[model samples]
Target chain A: MTVRSGAAARSGARGRPGAGGRPGGVARLVVRTVSEVCVTAGTLIVLFVVYVLFWTGVRADSAMDGEIGKLQDQWSTGPVAAGTPGATGGQPSGPGKQPPYENGKSFAVMYIPRFGADWSKPVLEGTAVDVLKKGLGHYGRTARLGETGNFAVAGHRRTYGDPFKDFPRLRPGDAVVLTDGTTWFTYRIDRRPYRTLPTDIGVIDPVPRESGYSGPGRYLTLTTCEPEWGHSHRLIAWAHLDSTQPVERGRPSALTG
Target chain B: MYGWIWRHLPGNAWVKALVSLVLVLAIVYVLFQYVFPWAEPLLPFNDVTVDRGMGAVR
Candidate 1:
């Protein structure tokens, strides 16, 4: 009877029949638990570290972009702010006259409500590492809204974890919204894909050889690598600026809420 | 991490060591899969930290 009782106690302790005969079970469990914790902590730490590092670059770039926008706004409104007519300070009045670069922390994300989880990643800037990882970057040289040329923004397609993983799936009539809380700009996809090398200037030509554009029309050329995995060709999506409004007012009607 | 667990788990040690390693890995996996997401928002590496300023006052 004593031997049977001992066997039962051992099994109960290990939760496996006859397992209590194993020595130091509790201690082993504790050690295993600690090791598991260490592994998990290490993984989380690595992920967090990478996220933080890139986040700083993202914030800085956003802030700098905001600053540039403020400066441009001041310059643009300076003449009006001073109540002067044609206060053009000998500066050209078109895309060529505008500053080649802008800085501002204010950026609005344009999401295609139509796309589901397929369009989850945020737009980041530049094809470069620092910018592509965070948020989309407006081409430093592209024209601004209400302008007469192809203003462009380029981003990575596959590398750096592919923020634009599904950009290739974009179809005609996708809506893009740019915002700074106070102002929101809506653009509609009017143009389809155009392939070119990064250095191909003709791809960004204000007027394509085939398409005739007249008057001052706002345009957007979103460029990324062609195909999903390779950079042999550049993929360009063209859109015309539809309207500009305050973000507080919500999305434009063309975007269908 | 599974990698870490696989690395640290005993191949040469007795059952005691292997059990110990397994327990540790389970704890870590729990912390990673369940706790890490919540903790992420509070970590020091957060881009949007508590301080609202860009280290400069207006």
Candidate 2:
């Protein structure tokens, strides 16, 4: 009986308490739970970063392609007249006289040779986030293409194909070409990218107060986020109207160069 | 805690693993679809503009 009782006592000690009642068991449980939570949170943060940086670019590229196709179809159906002032070999046209574009409507395609030979993105009216996601967005209050005053545009530098990813590489006299299905408007980069505040609306002024120009003239302003990944500040590049050419005249010297 | 969970859990090791996976997925889905979306605007991710000496720009 004594041997049997000792065996039973040992079994009891091993069976239940050893499984759940060990000293510091609660502390171990707490530490394990906290660590698991941290690991889960860390994984989630990584996934979110991937979604923002990589997935957005994929979605934006496809959307931009669709917008370009639609613009091409529209232009093909209603080709602009040849030999107009806005066309090749024609004289410079007057200001604010070109066709009016509706809000969110795509009116032209912008090319920055510094970006790449095949780099072109649709220019759509409005600076709304949704609009910029599709492609480069034109400031609604700014001047029209090839017109007097500041024709300002904005785009993302990090996501949505990062249209302005190489904006900083643009040097003075670099070409920023735009086409409205009829004529090509070439603007020469007059200033390298300058850092500015987002509220500095003066950068998009008729004369662009920040551009150091006091008088009204045909100016182009390109704005994007600084640091490539963050939007805490804006990087702006200023340009002036240099020339105009028709599609029939073929690509401009700026494009060829 | 894990030992307690193991003891309470029914069936074999595979059953426990599958249940744990499903539970983890449910928690992640809830956090992503509801908690994170609700908390995003409160974060600073949308503050695209800096406050220059002049004032807030954006």
Candidate 3:
């Protein structure tokens, strides 16, 4: 043991000349510094993963619930508060003509029966990162809720509350329902989940190119990451407006049933 | 590295340990509140849009 220790000490000293002339001084310092940096980096990565996987979901879920609660409060009252004009007690004229939705503002609540009975999420106006962290985001360019053109929305498939965690489970003839406080819009899925490149912006077009959609209609485009936890591609689902009912009537059959 | 931090800490053994823990906790809080939230969007997992721009805020 002593001989081996002596040999190691001598070798370490020879590894760095003029390094304090102390045995194993420079080599040990270099190794220690490298290892310490690596350990620190490894720990930071773990912490970041924890933040993305668990912390973001926790905060996002509460944020979504808060948005829903506030929208409900607005509904219980008469007209929606300012910043959301044209939120009337009367019937909607149709898509393409309505008050402009405030950016980062939640204007509706969405539900998919295929996801789960209790599943619900707020639909925000813009598809900003901050907005999506709270709830699903409406593509600014698409049609409004239940509008004639495509009303597209985006959501995280894995993190940020996992609004689209069950997106793949969506199949043809499934129902996607939404209520903008004044009206209940029920949209029926037209096809199964379609996987495409992220660059395929046509998926959210007025009549999505590959959704088997032939012409313009009251379409709904739902987009999320392709893989469960990665973003190498996009998963899309298209739906057509099936029916509409005034909020005063009650929840839509798609929800109650 | 931890030993260096412990040596530099101006306190008794227990106080030093407590300070170290507090420092770590403080760092984690900052990361969670500001750093992680900002850096998260810069990463790819949050990309749900159909646009091709990687980590695009759009």
What CA root-mean-square deviation does each model show from the true structure?
Answer: 14.3, 7.0, 5.4
For model 3, the stretches where C-alpha displacement exceeds 4 angstroms are A1-21, A80-96, B52-58
Fnat, 2 decimals, each candidate: 0.02, 0.15, 0.82
Per-residue C-alpha lDDT of model 3 across residues B1-58, encoded as one tens digit per residue: 7777889998799999899899999999999999988898878877899864532544
Comparing 1 and 2 on lDDT, the stronger one: 2
TM-score of the second chain in candidate 1:
0.47
- Candidate 3 CA-lDDT value: 0.84
- Top DockQ hit: 3
User: Residue A229, candidate 2: how far off, in angstroms?
Assistant: 3.0
Tell me the tens digit of each residue's lDDT in model 2 across A93-211: 67555655688878789988889999999999877656777888887777877766778888877766778888889899899999888888899998778898767778877887668
TM-score of 2: 0.75
Q: Please give, for residues A38-138, the per-residue lDDT of candidate 3 as tens digits.
A: 99999999999999889998999999999999998888976643322123322445543567689999989999999999999999988777888999999
Which has the higher TM-score value, candidate number 1 or candidate number 3?
A: 3
- Docking class for model 1 is incorrect
- For model 1, the superposed segments whose C-alpha errors exceed 4 Å read A1-106, A117-127, A159-161, A208-216, A254-256, B1-58
Tell me which of candidates 1 and 2 scores higher on DockQ: 2
Q: In candidate 2 chain A, what residue range of length 10 has the lowest lDDT sum? A: A81-90
